[model samples]
Target chain A: MIASLRLRAAVVSIVLLAVFLGAWHLATRSTGTAANMSPEYAKLMGMTATQGKSAMPGPLDVGAKLWEHLRRPFYDNGPNDKGLGIQLAFSLGRVMLGYLIAVAIAIPLGFLIGMSPLMSKALDPFIQILKPISPLAWMPLALYTIKDSSLSAIFVIFICSVWPMLINTAFGVASVRKEWINVARTLEVGNFRRAFTVILPAAAPTILTGMRISIGIAWLVIVAAEMLVGGTGIGYFVWNEWNNLSITNVIIAILLIGLVGMVLDQILARVSRLVTFPE
Target chain B: MSIFDDPFDADSRVNAGCICGQHRSPAEHEHAMSALRCEPVVESQEKRYENVVASAVLRAVFPEATTRRAFLKTVGAATALAAVSQFFPLKTATEAFAEAGTPEKKDLKVGFIPITCATPIIMAAPLGFYAKAGLNVEVVKTAGWAVIRDKTINKEYDAAHMLAPMPIAISLGLGAQPIPFTVPAIENINGQGIVLSMKHKDKRDPKDWKGLKFAIPFDYSMHNYLLRYYLAEHGIDPDTDVQLRSVPPPEMVANLRADNIDGFLAPDNICQRAIYDGVGFLHILSKEIWDGHPCCSFAASREFITSAPNSFAALTRAIVDATAYASKAENRKQIAEAIAPANYINAPVTVLEQVLTGTYADGLGGVKTDPKRVDFDPFPWQSFAVWMLTQMKRWGQIKGDVDYKAVAEQIYLATDTRKVMIEMGLTPPKDSYKSFSVMGKSFDPTKPDDYVASFKIKKAS
Candidate 1:
């Protein structure tokens, strides 16, 4: 029975792969044909006049470029020079630092406001006012105040990431059951012990949901912030490619951003599942 | 006692009491006692002990209850204080200014575009010209001319290498907010050229720019106006007869190569790149189209210039020195190498050298060594500014009429820039304004408005 199940799963996977590839092939062929006849595509679609030149490379060419960039990518083209690995590292470093800082401040503060009625009443207006402001609006101020691109970009990420985490954490903490509090009181458990043992464990799933939301926000803001700041990072890479008029590179950067965002969300999902009650 | 403890009698009495409580008795006091018995007593005891420890610890830390409100107030105050202390380093600001001298403001941030005109600024920073002047210069590469103007106007940038017309436009309230600006020095002149794709190299001649799809970096840029003048002189209407789109300098060659654009107006290095790439050709150098037209100038917010005069002078000196170095024949190759590696205009040194040397190849098997190909005259304010004002008037960018001279003076800081030039042993123009013949017709400086109104090309209806 196990062997049959494995065989069925294998067959399903192969069929899905075939469908995906077939669809991709059909789409590319149609787009290529349409592009050749269109006035807009005339510029980028034709063959170069060079002796061995061919038509502008299709999807296969993009795959080759991606593979080449991935392997042995550490080349310094000059002073502001770095490889794809270094660029990705720098981008990820800023995102992680900013995201961690956001969580460190947001979680405790969220708990305080959630646990106390008066505190929540006092702070709710302020959060409501600030949460609606766009991250881009803070960019000019951040640039002048911080006086550095990397720091400014990180600050932008931090500003954008904090709100979702704070909101979610507050909701999570406030929703702890009255029965649990009563049981803690009957046992004469300290407030700190009660919170850690009962409230936090119960709130884990919600807190993880906040983190997942925050990470997504961080990723979204980092690209735009880096583009404005302009240094070494994926955002810079995207801007540089656009400036160079290398649309292929821009598309690649977009793909990389999407892939990374997906992975981060998946990791957060797994963490949430690990902490939540099975039932 | 043995006689009294009868089992059946005792059981019957208890059963009767329970039945009475359930049916006969209206009050249920016995049920409450049973519910209390099922409560977890140990859990409450543990909670009490934990709360006691936590309270003790809190008292040890701070003897005041201060309520959560008071504590939050303290935290809020502390955060405000910490934020102020952490972000603003006023002491460093003074020290940086003091060490650099009053001539320059402390912590200087200079903005530049990715073009040959920005060479002097780039070279000066790494070569420590600003550092020597006691200014800490951070060179930032801007996206385009519009951003440079916006940032400078808003005081986000201390100063910027901007288009010659930008300060004038700002003074006239054209593109930017109406803020007074000053040009401390003319950074460079005649660095711009119009490049055509290699495909149209043979068909479209430099003499004819009317039929082609021409790209200018900005709508109101000096190049756009100059191109318009050029086409009109050749009896072609720039508006209806030709297509003009705004394309950034760096992307010009690619656009040309892609055949999306027939040609574009860009600085010299970009034109050189087209030649090197074997995909484009030089149609007309802007200098050739109009002799000694000002392309870019070093500008600062009027507030910065007035308050920090010494720093302004120091910056002017450094730029002047760099420009002098850049103009020398022997330094051409070195300048190319320095600029080529910077990723601003990532092209070969040879391409840059050709364009920088003023001996441009006309792509149609012709060469011209026009001595006036790239003139770096600092004080031709009247010609360029007046021309810009005229273009503005022509294009209806500025609708209402005002004193042209005052408008020009408000925009052009020629008097201030002349002082710096004199100190550097360069000849400053005696007259603030001058007139010159452009495309075989004399442009009168005195009658600037009339010159604009009399243009043969009809204004957009």
Candidate 2:
């Protein structure tokens, strides 16, 4: 019965996609041609004036462009024009470097805050204030202070991802069961060993959950950060296409961005699942 | 290393002693010699041209090579130059032949907002003008005017394509910190237009545009001042009569299509793009208000000019060369194809062709041809700065006492540009200041205060 339900759901998803594409194709079909235009003038008018094509690209146009991009995804023409693969690699590289740095700093600091109530209260106010400020808002300040556009983009990712991991790790570590700690203490395991052997195991699932949240936020913010500080990234690609007013390329970029974001989330979700323990 | 050292004799060590006995060993002397050789060996452009001209004159004077060599050996090279100068105007010919010097720093990054006003600067990168001037320049497409200013001020860019009034505003510390900026060359003139949304096709008059929303590229731009002047001349105050927003040129067409703005006064390429996309129509080219008005410029900080004078001169020569090339009507189509790629302006080739070639569809079922819709001229007139300053004062952007001429001369660099233009074989205007009329009102650079007072619908400061 469950297998049949899964099959039915997949069929419905495919049908929905097909319907959407059909509507898009019909909506953008050519309407009426202007026949009286001179050949010289008609050539300059583009397809919109001569053949009566819509300004918006049809689904087939977008699909063809997407296929063209996929065939050779790493061709770099210049500083402003690079293939999709190269742009995605640049954005992923920035996100990974920033996410790793955030993990290194936040996990350790969060452990300290979780173990001591006083320390948690002291750092709480600072984190609370920083957490609500939009990541893009920090761009100008980062660019001014960092003096490098690429590094500033990485810094924005780090600042944005750090807050989620910090908060979740602290909450998980602070809420560890009292009975497990007491048993470890009675066995004379010492503060260091007991915390590592017992407390770490109990909080592993929560820390992984925090990491999943942080990675998702980082992926979301990288696009916006890269758009603001344009050089070579998927965000820059979108901006470049937008400047050209190529809506088809922009739609393709949107689709690719969504696919990449989902893949990142799925990987983190899988890792979090592995760390979860059954009582 | 000594010339007197005998290598054949076992007792005499040739490689052991310095030539002048100034160093410990021959190796050290050789190292010192190489270091000296590395020091600026590339001659100045003028010097190189002079040598070539002097040699040609000597060859003409003596058809036989033996006789020319004998003459040079007897009189020496300096005496030959002195003799040649007596008969021929060698100095004047050399000045004419001198194109550009070897750049002190060849690899440069120039920031630009994607627009037709940056034609010379953008086209130079692809057409090899920078390479011809011994420069390896990368023209970067920036996001907006503010980013261009910041990147240039931060030294992230070696120079930038800026609005004609930006250098003046930057030097005066209007929007940003006071940085001594100079406009060595105006990039293009008469390249902007007022593009209105398609819904406003019937509403052609400025009187009908009172309650409509409009966008300008920047607050301290020629677009803002021109739009304001045009509106006020039509008996409508820009500040109170309509809503004005500062939108980047790239986003202007999108905004117009979405009904976020009713119109915009922007670069010609942007105006053309809106028409091409079937969203907007050209209301009036900027030249209709003031023919041959300055729009955008090639700007650099004073620090850059002082520190790297040769590179700056080479850059200026490249821009002037490109401007001269673009001014011709025949080269417009080729330039449009070159800059339409994703790396530069990132617009459709047809849109760029319409802008550069000045034969375009006006989105009202009519094809119009006005070759001077956009034109390139590298001369930075100080009078343009004076006119902009008067508008700034009239709009209350500047307050109290002002020295218009001093500021204009300080930022415009008209005299320096004149020298460069003469070197490039392009004839610049004889005088740096010229009085012109805007909307039937004459503006004399000598009397800026009177021009400001003449404005009836001013900011009332």
Candidate 3:
């Protein structure tokens, strides 16, 4: 029965996508073939102007461009132009580097804040003020202070990713059950050992949840950061195509961004599942 | 055949001379001559360098080609060089020029918005102008004029392709902290146009533009000033009668198609792209408002110039060299191809060709040709700067008392450009100030206050 339900759900998803695509295709179909235009004049006109095609590209146009990109996805022509695979790799690389750095700094600081009441209160005001600010807002400041664009982009990602993990880790560590700590203390476990063997294990699920949230946020911010400081990345690709007003390439970039974001989320979700323990 | 070839020698043909003197045009002669006299400069590299320097100094002292040639013929090249070296440190200057050829920093980054206004800066990279000058320069395609300004100011970029007024604005502390910036060279002139959406094709006259929204690339851009001037001349107050938004050049076409803007005064390529997209048609070229008006510039900070003078000079030489090549009509098609790659301007070849070649469809089912639609000239005239300042003050961007001439001379590096032009064997303009008219009203660079006061429709001070 469960398998049949899954099959029915998949069928519905496919049906919805098909209907959407069909409507888009019909809406964008060529309506008038430009008649009586000289060959020389037609050569200078865009596809829409000459063939009476809609300005908005249909799914087929996007699909064809996507297929061309997929066939050779690692071509690096120069700094401004790179293949989709290379662009994606550059973006993922930045996100991973930034996310890992955030994990390193946030986890330890979070532990200190979580374990001590005084530290938590002292740091709370600063965190509260900073947590709500958009990552892109720091672009100009980061660029000015750091004096490097790529490093600034990575720094932006780190700042955005830290707040979520820091807050969640502190919350999880602070809320450990009193009974578990009492049992560990009574057994003569040293403070260090207790942290590693008991507190860490007890808060593993929550900490992993925090990491998962951070990875998602980091992925989201990388696109915007790379877009702002363009050199070589998926965000740069979107911007380059947008400069030419190539909607088809932009659609492909959007689709790729969504897919990459999903993959990053799934990886963290699986890690979160690994740390979750049944009572 | 070459500028360096001796015009005094009866055996040599110096000024676009055909092998048989039967070619229909200079371009045809060049095509037919091919590689015959291209090896005219057979001197050693060092000798050629000294010769160029000597000739420039002689030309400067004489100010007349005939007298210089007569002097050279009388005393011979070696004696003439020795005589000049006595008055001027010829040997020391030659060594310095040679040393400056090896740039202090080899790797550099230049920021540019992907537009035809940046043709020389962009083409310099792909066509080996930078490499030839012993620098590996990466022309990073920037997102917008604001980002370009920020990145350059942060020292992330070595230099940048900027709107002509940007360096002035930066130097004067408008919209950004006052950082001493300099315009080493003007990139292109007369390369902008006012494009109206196809729906408003009949509304060509500026008087009919009231209640319509328009987009300019930036608040301090030539596009904004020209658009405002055009409107004010037509009795339409830009501030009260119509709305103007600061839209980046790249997004103008999409915005026009989306019906977000009725028109835009932007770079010629953006104007061409709008017509290519069938969303807009050319209302009037900016050249119609003011021909030979400065649009974009090759700018660097004063800090960069002080820290790395040699590299800055090399970069400027590459730009000036590329500008000279792009000035000729025959080279336009080749340049269009070189800058059309995905890594550069990233536009269709035909769109670029139409913009560069100055022959394009007007989106009204008509083909119009105007070769001077976009031309490259690298002189950074201080008079242009004075004109811009007057407009800035008139538009209320600058308030209180102003020293227009001092500011213009400081921001526009006319002296530096003159030196570079002489070094390259090109004639530098005698004076940095010249009067030019905008919309039938002449501007006297010597009297900027008068010009500012004369604007009838301006932001009331």
Candidate 4:
């Protein structure tokens, strides 16, 4: 019965995907003719017009382009041009560095603030004000002060990712069961030892959840930051393709960004699952 | 600060604390250091820079192009003029190709927007001009003009492709931080067009575009100034009569298609792109407005020029040489082929071919051939910079009085270009201050203030 349920869901997902792709294919198929176009322009825009293809790329075009990208993912032609894999790797490298920095800062500060009611109350307003700011707003200031675009991009990723993890870690640490903490106190376990053994385990799942969210955000910010900075990354690839007016390459980049982001989320989700414990 | 504050004075040249690198006395390098493992290459490169300086100084010194450096008095003046290039961090950096002058830095990054105007700059790589000059140059296509500006300013790029007016604007601090940007060579001339949406194919007159929205690549661009000049000449005030927004060139065509903008004064390929897509029509080329007007240029931060003079020289010479090659009509198709690769402009060969060859569809069902439609002349004229200053003042981008000549000399490095022209056996007009008419009205560069005052439908500064 369980196997049947899995099979049915898979079938439904396949049907939905097929329907989506089919609609996209039909909608973006060539639209207008080059019938009344200028003679010289007509010659240059031959297939793009005479074949009545829409200026926007179709699903098939994206699929073919994506296939091309997937086949050779690490070719580096020059400083401006690199394979999709290389770009993704650059993006992931930046994200991981920034995300780890956030994790390093957030978890400790979050723990100290959560352990003390005074600190939490004092920091709440600042956190509240800072959390809602868009990451890119810091770009100009980062670039001007840091004097480095790539470092500025990484800083943007760090700023956007830190707050969520910090808030979540604080909330998780603060909400740890009072009874379990009291028992640890009753046993007179040392403050540091008791906390690591008792409270840390209790808040592990929640902290992991916070970490998962931060990774998601870090991934999101890197694309936009790379686009702004324009060096080497998935965002740069999308922008470069857009400049080339190659919608096919942009679509392919978009797809790969999604794929990498999903993989990142799934990895964090798996880590969080490992930390979860039932009473 | 007074607008006439003369940021570039003679006293400042001797004592200025610039980040590019300080120059040693000319005699220090003359003896050839024990470190000169490659003295001959360095000396030759120095000779090249000297020729460029001599030619450029010769321009500043004489009105005629043929006054050779042989006349004793002229030669002494030329030596002094060449010495002027030394106090400034340009010549010696180019002289040494070995351990001493070995590019202070190799593996240089250059940024550019993917337009046909950037062909000479982009093609230099595949054509191996940079390599031939002992440079490992990597030219990356940038997202937009703003990013190129930022990346170059941030020191992320050693140099960049910019609109001719952008270096002037940056130096004057019109839109960003006040940094000394140098335009050593103009990349292309007359490569822009006014592209109107398809709906306005019949409404081609400038007077008729009273209420339409228009897009220009940047505020500090020849496109914006040219469009404004063209509009004002037609009695339409650009500011109030029509909307002009700074949109990236790639997005301009899309905006036109979406009816977001009625038209754009943009670089080639974008204009051709619109007509190719059947979404717009080419109304008129910028060349028609002012033939041989400088468009985009090869610009660098003053810091980069001083720090890596040799690399900068090699890069500029490569670009100038490339521009010389691109200027010839016979080699244009092959030049077009070289730049149309995926790593370069990434445009369809036909579009680039049309832009380079000057045979294009008018988007009005007519095939027109205008051979000088988009010309590539590398010399950066001081007068062009002066013209840009006037527009900035005319539009109120710059306030108070301007030391136009001093600013032009500082920003426009016409002297560097003199050598490249000599290398190619071409004589750059020593005094390239040639005046030209725009929209049937003559502009005297010497009287920029009068020119600005003459415009009727101006921004009311």
| Strongest candidate by lDDT | 3
Model 4 Cα lDDT, one tens digit per residue, B133-196: 6788889887778778888998888999999999998998878989999998989889899999
Q: For candidate 4, lDDT tens digit of each residue in A32-54?
A: 64476544456866365445777
TM-score of predicted structure 3 = 0.89
| Candidate 4 colliding pairs | A30-A52, A30-A53, A30-A54, B42-B95, B42-B96, B52-B419, B93-B310
- Judge candidate 4 at residue B200 and give its lDDT: 87
lDDT of 1 by residue, B123-206 (tens): 677666677656777776776776677667656678898877788777666755578877766666677877777777566544
Ranked by lDDT, the better of candidates 1 and 4 is 4
Docking quality of model 4: it rates as acceptable
Q: Which stretches of candidate 4 lie over 4 Å from their true place?
A: A31-41, B1-103, B423-425
The chain B TM-scores of all candidates, as shown, are 0.73, 0.81, 0.85, 0.78
Models 1 onward score TM values of 0.66, 0.86, 0.89, 0.85
Would you list the rank order by TM-score, best first? 3, 2, 4, 1
* Model 2 alpha-carbon drift over 4 Å, by segment: A33-41, A49-51, B1-101
**All models: lDDT?**
0.68, 0.84, 0.86, 0.79
